[model samples]
Target: MISPLGQSFRVSKVFKRCPLEIQGFVFSADLIELSFRKFNLILGMAWLVEHQVGLDCVSKRVTLKVGDGEEVVMVGERRDYLSIVISTMVAEKLVQKGCDAYLAYVHDTSAVSSTAEGIRSVKDFSNAFPEELSGLPPDREVEANIDDDPNRAEFWLENTIRVFDELSCTPEECMKCVVSLLRDSTYQWWNTFVSVIPKERITWEFFQEEFRKKNINQRFINQKRKEFLELKQGRMIVTEYEREFVRFSKYAWECVSTEAIMCKRFKDGLNEDIRLFVGILELKEFIMLVERACKDEELAKQKRKAMIEARDTRKRPMSKSFQPQSKRSKETNLRMTISSEYSH
Candidate 1:
């Protein structure tokens, strides 16, 4: 596959042309090295094993455990994708040093891991190797449309947090990763934010604490706070209302950051009837507020059903002579009335 920076390569034909000699020895996909220069030949797993080349990923260093020691080789990467590419001279150096190191190591029969034929300093390059190599397993938005969707903005934050949590990285590293993934308008917005923030090397914890005071991102929170206040439990089920309340509350931290304020804000958003039924006096805590909202929602539903039944009873024809205007008249009338009233 090609790298993210568009450094494309194709070498399948080589193996196709000499399958018997090259099939298990090497293949095209093995050329995805962090090369530093152009190469006349691309080396594969066979060459690596033969040279006892070992990759040290964490330090970004390539090591060849030849003889009694190893050397670190620096392979430069493409800036766009961070994929490595190196020059032909570097490749030759790698191969030459690797041969010397491994030949020295393998020539000693007691090296245990490798057995080059005839043990004593092998001259040929083809047979001084091992058999196997192990496996290698490898949004945006906001301010403008961010105002239009505080919910979506919060979603992006939560998603980014989850990505970082999975990595167990520091908050700074997490934010950096998230920023790097942004593109287009979102990228531009973040870049502007980066530029505006004081140019100092600060930990994420410090920046997160100070960002609000230093940035214009308060609009999102203001929007959410407005939504939170405007929320109504009127037609929404208790569960749905709870979700809305929580979603809006995420952005409106100042208004509902405390237990009393949150409960009050939540209670105030409920439909008047449910709020009255649940009784603000009874909700001393956030949990109580949620439970009563749910209870009141069910109470409201039962009340509605009883009212409908009572209205039906009142509208029904009492006399047999008055009952036969139409077979579907009563049910049809009730359906029409309900639809007319709630269509808004």
Candidate 2:
């Protein structure tokens, strides 16, 4: 599939289906999801040039009866196949996956012991994640990310899927059995309020569909990203500004795809003095920028304090050294002054 940025990635392996053989014709069954948001499965008609597969036009249906077995009746308008499409996220994900595949292919001849191996057996999977619920502590909420960590969600996703694969259950089962592990209000809200499903129709795909319908919203994510982009420290203290930036980090995935971009965006939203201070430093990492901003602000505060103290010292009156008069001398002076006043 081609991404929006003109990048291409492979999704599936090229494989021929086990066909239903007739006098010389063959057919393969296909499972297709009937959604406008879906991509079309390809079928080759080169073989049909010699052997014809009859098509029925009525009832907006097509029938291919090349086989002696039961004819295939496809419920769709008959037209030549045109094109396929994929979502932008899906395309990018595929491209990322393809990179790994390309690397493996290029290094196919490398010794296994030379490379890092992470594969584990099914026993390991079963041991680590038994097909049971792992309840959470009370009031705990499983957030998308944790404590300003950008990789938290990705880490969670990797482990969650590994456990899910080990369980070998439907998504509903996974959700239900997993409920014991979470006592958070968010999880409870999802379990008690959002998890309404017809028992007969419960499936992993349906669960994902409902989950996205109830939880994930692209427009909401986009709005949060916009807020992150426009955020400024303004008059807020360092800690407050950092908190706000961290709070909205998860939504702005694209903005932080690279450390350079993250650094630039974060630098743009900083206060002028902080920006100038941070700019002078060779900071490339987001964490480094946060640390430096905090450090610089503190230094600025100390400098201002020192300047104030110096100004205050300069404003004060200076005291000069003076000798104390003897008691007898003071008394004599006082007596002379009193007598002079009386004579006057």
Best-matching candidate per lDDT? 2
Write down the lDDT that model 2 would get. Answer: 0.62
lDDT of 1 at 77: 62
Assess candidate 2 and give its TM-score to the true structure.
0.37
The segments of candidate 2 whose C-alpha lies over 4 angstroms from its true place after superposition are: 1-174, 178-209, 216-219, 318-344
Please write out the lDDT profile of model 2 over residues 1-344, one tens digit for every residue.
65344444455434445465544555664432332244544344554432355654565565565435656555655344332333545644655444322223355566665421354444445556575635423432344422133244234444666787653344655666544443455355556744475566755565445444445556666787888888999998878987888778778787778888878877888888888999988689988888899998898889999999998787664422355778999999999999999999
Tell me the spans in candidate 1 whose CA falls farther than 4 Å from its real position: 1-154, 172-176, 185-202, 206-216, 314-344
Query: Using Cα atoms with residue i matched to residue i, what is each candidate's TM-score against the true structure?
Result: 0.42, 0.37
Give candidate 2's error at residue 52 in angstroms.
Answer: 79
Candidate 1, residue 130: Cα displacement in angstroms equals 66
Candidate lDDT (C-alpha), each: 0.60, 0.62
TM-score of 1: 0.42
